[model samples]
Target: MEEEKILAIDYLATTPVTAKDKRLKARRDPWMSRVLRYTLEGWPTTVDNELLPYWRRHEELSVREVCVLWCDRVIIPRVERPAIIAELHFGHPGMTKMKAVARSYLWWPGMDKNLEGTVRACERCQQRVKAPPRALLHPQLLPKRLWSRIHVDYAGSFMGRMFLVTVDAFSKWLDVYATQSATTEVTSEKRKTSFAIHGIPERLVSDNGTCFTSSEFRTFCESQGIIHTKSTPYHPSSNRLAERAVQTFKDGSRKLETRSLNETLQTFC
Candidate 1:
């Protein structure tokens, strides 16, 4: 039985590790190490109050190369979360960009709220994240496949920079970039990163902003064999999914704004 358990451990340690992984292994996190042990030895039928969160995700929890993974994302150790947050927030990415980066490969309880706290603590972000008032709109069309139809828009001069936000019509996956300019050229360059990863969408939707309506942008879309579309100019109820998505992004990031830190800790505690 011990040999079989050892074999299972070795088999489960196949995921590749990075400097981050090395650091994680060295830390010997009490909670994460316990979770790793449970994954190998099997979880108890019931858990302590502290282990309840991990228990809820026990079915998806996995051990990967000495790291605990929730799905494909690494379960960040509490001690390491601050560093991860700093790395992801290095570019001073806005709420959308921050969440996009965080959701890519990291997970911890209250991660989203913590990210929001980091942003709210920033005097600079509070100063520059002014966006247009959201307008009510009808439902936007959903696509059959990811990257088939995407709604794109600008969020703000957030953090003293322009943000280009694109929402996948199917997955609703958000792509955000912080740029010094919102020019058509810059927008095209930013979209290239997303397009490279997800492939160019067959249909691209955006409001009739100059960045989208400009002849240069039209040419760029044509070159990529993309079908460029514009939302109705003034009618709020027409087509505005991109704006709605941006609104959702902004709203979700700030939902915890009113809570005090001590209160936040008490709830989690």
Candidate 2:
């Protein structure tokens, strides 16, 4: 009997793995693993157990290979099987439906319990969809006088393009100048010309982008009798007015599907 069992195992081992072999495929499937683990103990083991014979036959297959075969043959064939599984006498339908969705994607062997744990951990489903954005700590009251506090910044360049932005705090008046480069040499010259046309403002707020923080920009501000201030790192709201104006221009430009920032700035102005 033992020699016969060994011969059977050897014969099964020589068989090529294929989808047509359901008995071979089930041994590798995680869902089937769970089912077998729960119920196989109740069945008497023969001289050569069914699982041992199958494993001997497919000893060359890796776990991942087994999973792929199982998915392709078993899981994909019954695409909505989890939903039907949900119908098989269980808990809340809502809970069951979620499990159904999760199982549809996450149902590899050993994942059934982990998927349930993940479903339990979702806070969004536990509560409402959204909470109102926290109240703004600093409401932006527009400066009462034009040019009393100005915001200036550079946008777009380093790939050989540039646009300079200046906005009057009160009127929200915006001026955009296209520059050939973002270097101090080009930016300082452009600032001089812009301020010459619009007159120097009391304060300039900007981010710490290299174009704004350059030594040339500081010297230009000093020469123009303008006070230069910078926003906190990554915190654009420190230069709120100028920041909002820039966003408005970019968003409108994108919505209009235009190539020219000049045209977008013109619309905003």
Candidate 3:
């Protein structure tokens, strides 16, 4: 409706064509050109309110013109469709905005089938309805040796008690501590016990949780000669191994049933 209203053309007249020339020779398609020109002229009025900063800046381009030029000329002809789909799913600002941005580029494939299913199967969209593409930050480095690089994170408790896990970077060994309260004092005591058993690590990596960020924890790390490292506030990849470990655990769990269903059932029983 907005596209039709903004383009000032009957939707039926603007048949979707997967032609690079559509955008390239946009000025030549008399009917389409008039609609695109008018849309571009009225972009400031129609899209100014709905779009973000980047999209807003392209107000000089009509809806059809922008779609044709940006989609066909820039995206379809040059960029791979799968990559474009991924970028649409992950790299864009928001889901709604991404779809809106994608609509401009979406065209009949140049001798391909319907892309609706492919577009819908995007994982990011499946996980988050309309989340914006978060800018990726640089990976942080550990300031020490292999096992000395300790990463502690809490997980599960989805069905049972939460487990605080300390992972060794080298051996991929995990030391899990089941805890009732994730208090600063409790966490400190657990860390001390862990250090006593496994010896002090050169560096410790953790989320910016209250327990991890507490003065007591910092003092404890300082006292133990262990450097405390806080992960990027919300980014998990700061200690990327944690993600890998979780995936490994999930994969192994999935395999357990398949590799030996009888053994798995026996073990559970």
Q: Which candidate comes out best when scored by TM-score?
A: 1
Error of 2 at 120 (Å): 40
* Candidates 1 and 2 compared by TM-score, better number: 1
Worst 10 residues of 3 by lDDT: 7-16
**What is the lDDT of every predicted structure here?**
0.70, 0.52, 0.53
Off by over 4 Å in 1: 1-140, 233-239, 251-269
lDDT of 2 at 130: 42
**What is the per-residue lDDT of model 1 for residues 229-252, given as tens digits with 9 covering 90 to 100?**
787867532336778766654554
Sorted by lDDT, highest first, which candidate order results?
1, 3, 2
Q: Write the per-residue lDDT of candidate 3 for residues 20-62, one digit (tens) a residue.
A: 5446555554434444555455543443322332244343333
User: Of models 1 and 3, which has the larger TM-score?
Assistant: 1
The reply for model 2, stretches above 4 Å from the true place, is 1-142, 157-160, 233-237, 258-262
Write down the TM-score for model 3.
Answer: 0.39
